[model samples]
Target chain A: MMVMTQENLTSKERFDKIFEVEFLPQIDALYTFAYHLTYNEDDANDLVQETYLKAYRFIEKYIEGTNAKAWLFKILKNAFINQYRKKSKAPTKVDYEEIINFHDEENDTNYSTHTDLREEMFQSMMGDEVTNAINALPVDFRVVILLCDIEGFTYEEISKIIDVPIGTVRSRLHRARNMLKGQLKTYAESLGFKDKRSKD
Target chain B: DYQELVRKVTMYLDNELSEAEAYLKVLSQEKSFREFIKSKLHRRKPSPALIKSIKDKIKT
Candidate 1:
């Protein structure tokens, strides 16, 4: 077995420390990401299980002071993609050039949807509405939003986790938020929140 | 200008910018924008049994 050169623990102790500290605490976060990707509890649990298995086997490569969360997230994302590829019998379709080339507001056809709405408008937005809106987004856009908004990862960190450029992370987030804004507005309006712009 | 505002807001949200940045100052005053940024999405937790299963695998 390979050793972590910088860490003080021996191999057995290192495995225990990695699990107790770095890996176990992140199971919730990893499961959340996996759930959003698969939208199935069993598949998500399987993905998380596989991720920890792989992380355990390769624990020697994990630098001690580095971002353990980001490393695990990268592994989870890759596992999700691999499973997706195998099930689909095709490569995961990513149009990186399109994501890279698209302008943030080019297709923001709902620009004035809820931009002027107040905080009270969203107070009535139940978690189910928010969850459904996020789940409805395309996976690329959804992943960035989950990482940045829900999980609160930095753009640079998300870019590394998802294997995209920082610019792409920004573009995807902008688009995702815009999409969510429109969807959430529909739910809010349904729940009796007025679009202030509709008043104007 | 909207794109620039988004960039600034994103940078601010991620703590990449100083709190004193002018755009962030304006953003801080916008309660609605703050609500939007709050992203009240539901996050699911893994089952305890699954966690136990993984831990068992790791220990073996």
Candidate 2:
């Protein structure tokens, strides 16, 4: 059997190993998330670098074999809020519209009898505008939508990440989706969405 | 009723629905909204330079 020389690995070597194995893989995801949060390539790069720096600094506290991605994400998110958010001009929040008003505007819930193929056609139309709509949101609302809709995190996972109660996550998600629907309403209508049910 | 439908839209997209038919119905009712959210499902990774930069910056 080969000798297991544990002491041969220096602290920097060990740190490099963990960083390469654990942290490096999450760079793209962290950058993508950073991009969505900051809405600027340069800011995203800065945010991601800051996150990696922090993660490296506190690498000793990180537990191996756990969810490294989530841990990195938590650090990135905190870094985004603590660093990027404070420098941005948008106020942290707006008044919560107790009722989601988008659906209330045109509730002609008369289901369109469009074929699956036609539905697919409409789905194909929903590309770039969705990205624009997502980016247009205030940072706080945008984060929830990105975490839930884009990243596919569950409400509980998001609650844990954002350090909010699950109920808050739910409400925030609800509001964010409503806001997106409102922003995309015009674009959606132009694609033969509104009043198409009347024809069908 | 539309708010109820909106909730269904969120649940359906979230894969929380038990029945596929129910999800399709939710999609059918909130057609535009469903399509919009589904479109956000695609992936986007960072550039190679960003990855290299992270690697470079992490060194002591």
lDDT of 1 at B5: 70
- The candidate that wins on DockQ is 1
Model 1: per-residue Cα lDDT over A1-200, one tens digit each: 97546555466796688778977899889998898788778889899999999998898899876899999999998898788778789666777776764555456765346443534454554346766777789878988877876688988899999999988887887788778768888776676654453211
- Model 2 pairs in collision: none
Off by over 4 Å in 1: A1-9, A90-127, A192-200, B1-3, B18-40
Interface RMSD of 1: 4.2
Error of 1 at A3 (Å): 17
How well is each residue in A1-200 modelled by candidate 2, as lDDT tens digits? 85646664576688778888988888877887888786667788888888888889998888876778888888889988887546676676644552445345335454344345557865665556877788778777888888876677877778888899977887788888778878877877787666232211
| Model 1: number of backbone collisions | 0
lDDT of 2 by residue, B1-60 (tens): 357666756666676556852545556756556555666645557777877777776653
- Model 1, residue A149: C-alpha shift (Å): 1.1
The sequence of per-residue lDDT tens digits that candidate 1 reaches over residues B23-57 is: 44445533354355354556788998998898888
Q: Which parts of model 2 have CA positions greater than 4 angstroms off?
A: A1-14, A89-129, A194-200, B16-24, B29-35, B38-42
Span of ten consecutive residues with least summed lDDT in model 2 chain A: A191-200
lDDT of 1: 0.76
